[model samples]
Target: MASAVLDHDPPPKHLDEDEDNDCPIEQVRLTVPTTDDPSQPCLTIRTWILGIVGCVLLAFVNQFFSYRSNQLSISSVCVQILALPIGRWMARVLPPTIIRIPLLNWSFSLNPGPFTMKEHVLVTIIASSGSGGNYAVGIVTIVKAFYHRGINTMAAMLLTQTTQVTIFTPLNPPLKKKQFLICFFFLRSPVAGIRLGRIVQEILGGFSVHVCDSIQCRALNEEERRPKGGLSRLQFFLISLGCSFAYYIVPNYLFPAIGSVSVLCLIWKNSIPIQQIGSGLRGLGVGAFAIDWATATSWLQSPIAAPPFVLVNVLAGYVILIYILMPLCYWTNIYHARRFTFLTSHLFERGGAPYDLDRILDAESFSLDVRQYESYSDIYMSTFFAISYGIGFATLTATLSHVFLFDGQYMLKLWRQATSKANEKFLDVHGRMMKANYAAVPQWWFLVILVSMTALSIYACEGFGGALQLPYWGILLAIAMALFFTLPIGIIGATTNTFPGLNIITEMVIGYILPGQPMANVVFKTYGYISMSQAITFLSDFKLGHYMKIPPKSMFVAQLVGAVIANACYFGTAWWLLTSVPNICETDLLPPDTPWTCPSDSVFFSASIIWGVVGPYRMFGPGSIYVSLNYFFLIGLLAPVPVYVFHRLFPEKKWIRLINFPVIFGATGMMPPAKAINYNSWFVVGFTFNYWVFKRHKQWWGRYAYVLSAALDAGTSFMAVVAFFALGNYDIYAVNWWGGVLDDYCPLANCPTEAGAYIPNGCPQIQ
Candidate 1:
């Protein structure tokens, strides 16, 4: 849907009438400063050194944690915070020496006055190279761990490089129509998806940037003073951060059960049915809550940053999907729902046993064996996992239709305003100032880079032993897909802070066309998915520069350099662990206490098995049990129609306009990884800060809401790293009391609800 409430926001009159307060988006008008400092230096010596170091540090730390079960991603916010004091220190200690290249007539200074906000922003942009954490590294992990195959370093590094680079360029049209025929053969039920995709592309006419990032960067630039008797922004942030750091030790370590305590589980400790209703991680989570910010905002994020309506709509949708619909389906035993646990992501065989994935795969080729598969039972999943996919399917179409119906014309206006010089006066004052001040990066840069990367991407898959059987034609389709979805997805992500991926769609297409090639499927999925996501990141960086008034050419240089080094470091780190760490990611072979499970990569490996090896022909093709779910396309396509009509019927009813089916349906989109505690706690905090406090205490909320969010994130990242090293790494230092367990004291939540179901490992089964 329209990501945030900024589409048609009325400009506020708090600022002086003649000032630069005429930005179309209200949040930007409110947060970004009206003036610029043209004399302030941007690309100083402090910027490059700090940026490069931050990029390497983040890449190493994040990749290190990726293999552990308790994964902690260090964000660019961390660099934004940590680099400030060091930057100020460098500004003081370094000599004011001028360095000039006489041949090129270029000059720069060592100590460029006090470190400027523009410099701080440039450093964060550089660090952002590793912020998304190299999506292609999972290919290295899954191949080494799951497939047990050795890869060519050149091939792996090329795959990593291409995925890390995000580009948006027009491509040469279909070379041979014959290749299109082969792709078309694979488009069966996904043909139904054509309308869904068309719905999104129909209204792709605007550009936006991450609203939350804008809010966070306010600290680095703005010079406003705190009111009388109020804490300064830095003091308030440090206080809140200290509190966050100290408070985490309780719920995250000493008293873990408080992280997600379910009242029903505590009251009826022995009742499986009651526990099933209350278990936060593995069940319905009827009365669950978490005190820990890490647990509460694990996947949902700190709600203090979201708009009130966004939080309410998401929570409303989550309750309907998880509490009402899922429980009903489970209780009634649809598709043998009770045969599995309530909230698991695991696949199962019939009769309640875990699916033996290796049993159906050919050992040598890593492809599905029809003979072995015929003897084995059909694939089954928890009702939660199956239904969630159906929700995702509907959400895509709903997102497309909702955006088109609600936001199309406004976005079209923005596109026109952005492109034509005649409409430049109507543009935001910030945009006008940026254009006036900075030399723009030449368009030819993108053209040259796109051609070079596309060529390398092809050679990475095809030239390497022809092992990755993705033909050159597949790359063309992938680029086409990425170009099509990038703008639409970017709009939603920038506005709502929610980014939906094309991994599923990409895998479905290639797996169907070229089944039995695992690397090909995953590599293609990486290309299709990461291209759009990284491109969005690239856009967000530019927007950050846009708001901060950094020169476009300087920003371009910073990003290009950072991305290259960060991509290399990320690959080097993953490759080092894969080669040196004994039995890494192999849980059975490692010691009982080993912490190298590669949880995300395990899921990635499972996807390769599901889509690549077995292919859609077996999973969702004709005669498949899930074939019925293909109708979600029709359901989603029609969902937004009612909302659109209602708005037309009664334009005065504003709340009706706020009702977004995609936001609600997509609320449960992160369920496989996110628990109910995340959603429930997020909604409560968001409502308190953004709604109640926003109206009740306007001054305080405006000054501290986003600052508080940033502090909490930074503190949590720091503590997580400390906790991992101090206590989480060893059994001896871990808390020994009953409170140490993180679950809601609901052991039975792992068991099946069906009367005659078999339990794995001979766990007690109900009769």
Candidate 2:
């Protein structure tokens, strides 16, 4: 259930030692250097200090340009532009690619571009922001706004998705492609920052940086070098076509039976036991049926089968329990990893010539600890209700406060240790200072590139779709806000700051400004969705860098370039066309009602108030009760369930399994059901599968399953892109149901109906 976007990818290390290959992995070497005096300055901190300060100023500048006059919030666009300059700075950590520009000498750093850890991180962060954040925000908003009747909203949203195949067939492929690409890139991109950071360190320290044919050099191996694998690319294309065709004709035929079967297959293949899967499926079934039934049952108390209120409470309880307990518990694991580093090598097993676990974990040998926790006891009890309750009470005065803030010294120590290990493993030396070898670009040069890229993207998105107005600026602003707000928070929220509440707030803004226009609404929603998706993608990559001891500064730049490439190649053109082209409905490939076009302004408005205001109240007042009550109950539930279940089943030495209970919290929190599962049914299926595959088949499943899942995801995304674009699925349809169905119906001469043909409002002047 964790967002794939937020999960860090494994640092690639190729085993085949081929001299003729240009694999970066071949160049990478792991060596440990002598530790120096702790008094010496850390370049990583300096880079962040400068970058952070510069970024805040950049954010203010972007805000100035965007919010100056445009009520629509062009600040997002400014943020994107601002990133270019930051990107340029980030590029120094990349390999310098010199280009012949006739009279002008041109060179750019491919640090975050091509195949690099930073590229992976950026894409992952962004994607997490979108996919993980989207569902989280949606669930949270629905819960907050419709607390008494939130089931209706959740049902409505699900119902809306049911129509996704029938209504937005053209858009789904593109959306899916982007999602897949971001995930793919994160999983595949190889080492970037460590090599470049080493070079930069050499430059700053005036140490000679040299090229080598050694298999241990700090570069991605040939197999992992290419940003996109052929298989993955082919898969995206195929999936796109498959989804389009399925939407065009199969939905009405296939969804009834095939959908359920597919869900079962996915569940079965995933390794979940039938029993647990059944429990989850049962919950989902009750939820799905009850929502619609409740709505039907509640029309002036006209009885459907059961009372609507009963359905509401049951569904709400399930949702609340799932979101609160499952996610909360799993987060305990993530928190445990973040807070108490027993050993990086122990927590994560990244295979391919295993680095010495002893060397990696030995506290005396390497500074393995970062973000010092008060104690292992604190981390173990992060899920403890009473302790956290006291802390939560203090944080009530501030929305940003947490019960277990990582001590700065602890993080510094960890950073030093990670750096020491990376240097020893890759550089064979320590005490190398971080500095840029290349000169900084003039402000004007950065401006020119930024303007040019922005212009091209705008043209691609707008020149085609005359109907859907893509908020290019909003995308920029959102990125800027993410950069400014999330970097410091680190491992907070579901996945960094790509929290759903943030995106939902953005959607609400879109609704507030451009209400009644479904086309605009959807396009704007895409901007919010895509930005966050990439944010989490990038964040995950960064996490990988952390684990691998890659330089944080270099990773930062690689992520920026990854974002730029993804936007240009995958999302920019596709999103533009989705917005411009208006004939998608003619092919009967998609539904007419989408989140953007749904008659849900009330929902949006309510969400804005609830998440932006009421939900935040948990930090104070009676709202804190929810956090406290849930925290305690979760610990109690976790403590005994592991012991009880194992004891009841095995009846011998169940205490061995008792120790594994904390993992439940970590897994559940690290993986949220929202991002991981498409629907409630999938959640059940995934939970069972995860437990079965991970717990039972730890010997075989542990080693190969992650690889398989990653492979499957990469294949799925690759096929999606090719299939959608090559087949022209978005362009294949040419119908405007809203315009045609109600253009001449006995409404006014011209009306501005939201999306459906129903006369929800009086007619306005027809364009």
Candidate 3:
């Protein structure tokens, strides 16, 4: 059957001498092998064992990091790194016994010949799938910390699990239709529909037998046809890990100030110029490390993940806009930037005090009481926060327009091919493998999951007083919203590595529908936005498995297992942290140097207040200070038209195609959670790696660059996780020296006062 699948397509043609100089997509397609060697072992006991261990480790680490002030997420790259060696070791040590299943007529090996790249990738993917920090855990945290409501551990776990599980519901109907048609035609038996539907359910739920076989088939063929030499997989993994270990010390412990520097302050300090510059330089160093660490797991994965030119374009825009334009705007006090922090999402009063939500919400219900809100003084926002809203609105419009303008023709062709009989030609190596080896998941199974999860969600919401008592119709609306936006968001994320968030839109829509009910609004938004995002994430993983030639059934089992493990681990970890750490998320109660501030949850809670309790109409409607900001939507709609027109007029201006406006503006609002130094450092690293190294040394870049990225991310994340449990959780300090302390070296980095002014907040006055 495998041999028959291979015979369908002729071997891929060799690339021309000039192929390297072609477009990035074309170059990647030519250079990288698309399929794995089919003869190698894929599913084994070793794979499952390593996968389970990796999943547990990564889930715990991710949940641990979620509460930290710096908010470092453990990337899937960590799993990829650790799993490679384990897999190789297993291949060597495990007995090569072929186990035969009697009635199923299937046979599998305890040890595959050598742990193939496909198996290694599959193990990593499964582990990494579990590494995503569960967002539902935040619900428990927020209720405990901010709302002062305590839900039992069992209830919290159930809520978190059910919310995540229910997201699978809305996705099933479409998947079922597609899978059933394929299964019916392939099997030539309507009765097999029940069997196939189960398989489809597994696939949808993140298990698969032949998910990545199509892509791997091409890769395998390429390897046989032309064996290009590079570093061995083990060698590559080791080098990355070694580099990461070495790089970890600089940013993490030795020179924490390297993460962010107040450049202006360094130049202005006449008495301590050398000391100031040294501190600033350290910040730059840390920033660069952070940039490399972040990029490796995200952008530097597969060459096809993000094209080099696209990275260059983003760097260019970010540098020009953020470094140059934003600084100029700040200096000139445009949008009153000097009166507030240069970058923060937080709203502020005109006098620089934080916007108080308690003033607007009712004392008991915690919902917006219009009469009380009207009586309070008018609210003001930091210039950046206000600008973020405008840019966020604009990002959505620009993204939609850009997609329609650039990808419309291709999408149309794809749709046509999908609908027509010619879809067979479009099937990749993985798809072919799936057809040959795997049975389609059954449709009814998805229906069962969907119905059960939906019922559980409704029961939890309505029955629990502490939880949001959202009506059944609101839940349905959330589901509908998720369904509607999933495709568009998925398209953007796949193509551009940018997701124009549905959170804002979902909040706005829900706020209007259920005004005065802040809790319900948040609940609605969570279901609508997070669930949709989760669906996209799951689908993307399925695609990754497809690329690696993992069997669809095995992939399904891995994901199901990983999900369960993650739910338990995340809940336990969160509960432990909340209990152990006093004044857990309260920055004021803890020592000033503490790292326990839940930055993400703070953002979430604030957002709930702004969009939910206060409502958008009062905030951005007529007679409001932010009324003019609403015009940004129209501005955003029109922003891309000129670019599209210019591209048409000069079809050869390829750079125009690279101008991703959404990405450029999307980067502007990342200040409070992310500092300016991060962006500056990121640009420097991106230029050095993606632009200089890639252009000058193509093969070396392709082989070593992504590996290096994976290494650094894993090393830093692992070390951080270790440090947290070993020292951070205990509130133990390494030393009381300058290097050991947090970056107070740039105290004036976000000072609201003018450079020469001092308002008794302990910031130095400019001479």
Best by lDDT: 1
Give candidate 2 misplaced runs (Cα > 4 Å): 1-101, 104-257, 260-284, 287-319, 322-488, 493-557, 568-571, 574-577, 580-689, 718-767
* Model 3 RMSD vs true structure: 7.3
| Candidate 2, residue 413: lDDT | 45
State model 1's lDDT. Answer: 0.69
The RMSD of every model to the true structure, in order and in angstroms, is 7.8, 22.4, 7.3
TM-score, one value per model: 0.86, 0.35, 0.80
How would the candidate models be sorted by lDDT, starting from the highest? 1, 3, 2
Error of 3 at 588 (Å): 2.3
Q: Say what the RMSD of model 2 is.
A: 22.4
lDDT of 3: 0.58
Q: List the lowest-lDDT window of 10 residues for candidate 2.
A: 67-76
Q: Where's the lowest-lDDT run of ten residues in candidate 3?
A: 184-193
For lDDT, candidate 1 versus 3, the one ahead is 1
Give the alpha-carbon lDDT of every model.
0.69, 0.28, 0.58
lDDT by residue for model 2 over 1-767, one digit each (tens)? 01111222333232222312221222222321122122111122223333343333332222221110000111111222223334446545645443333553432223323233223223233332111112222332223232212223232232222111010001112122211111111211111112122222222121011121111122221233223433332233344435543442221121212122223323343221221122221111222211111111111111111122222322333353444543454335333221211111111112112123223222332212222311221112122222223222222211122202222343344346434533333222221211111111122332343445444434433544332344556435433443332322232222111121234334545555544333344444434444333333344444333323333334434344333332222222222333443432121233432111111222343233222322223222253423343343334333534454565577687344323221222222211111112233333333444555557876444333333332322232223234335533443312234321101122221121122222223333222
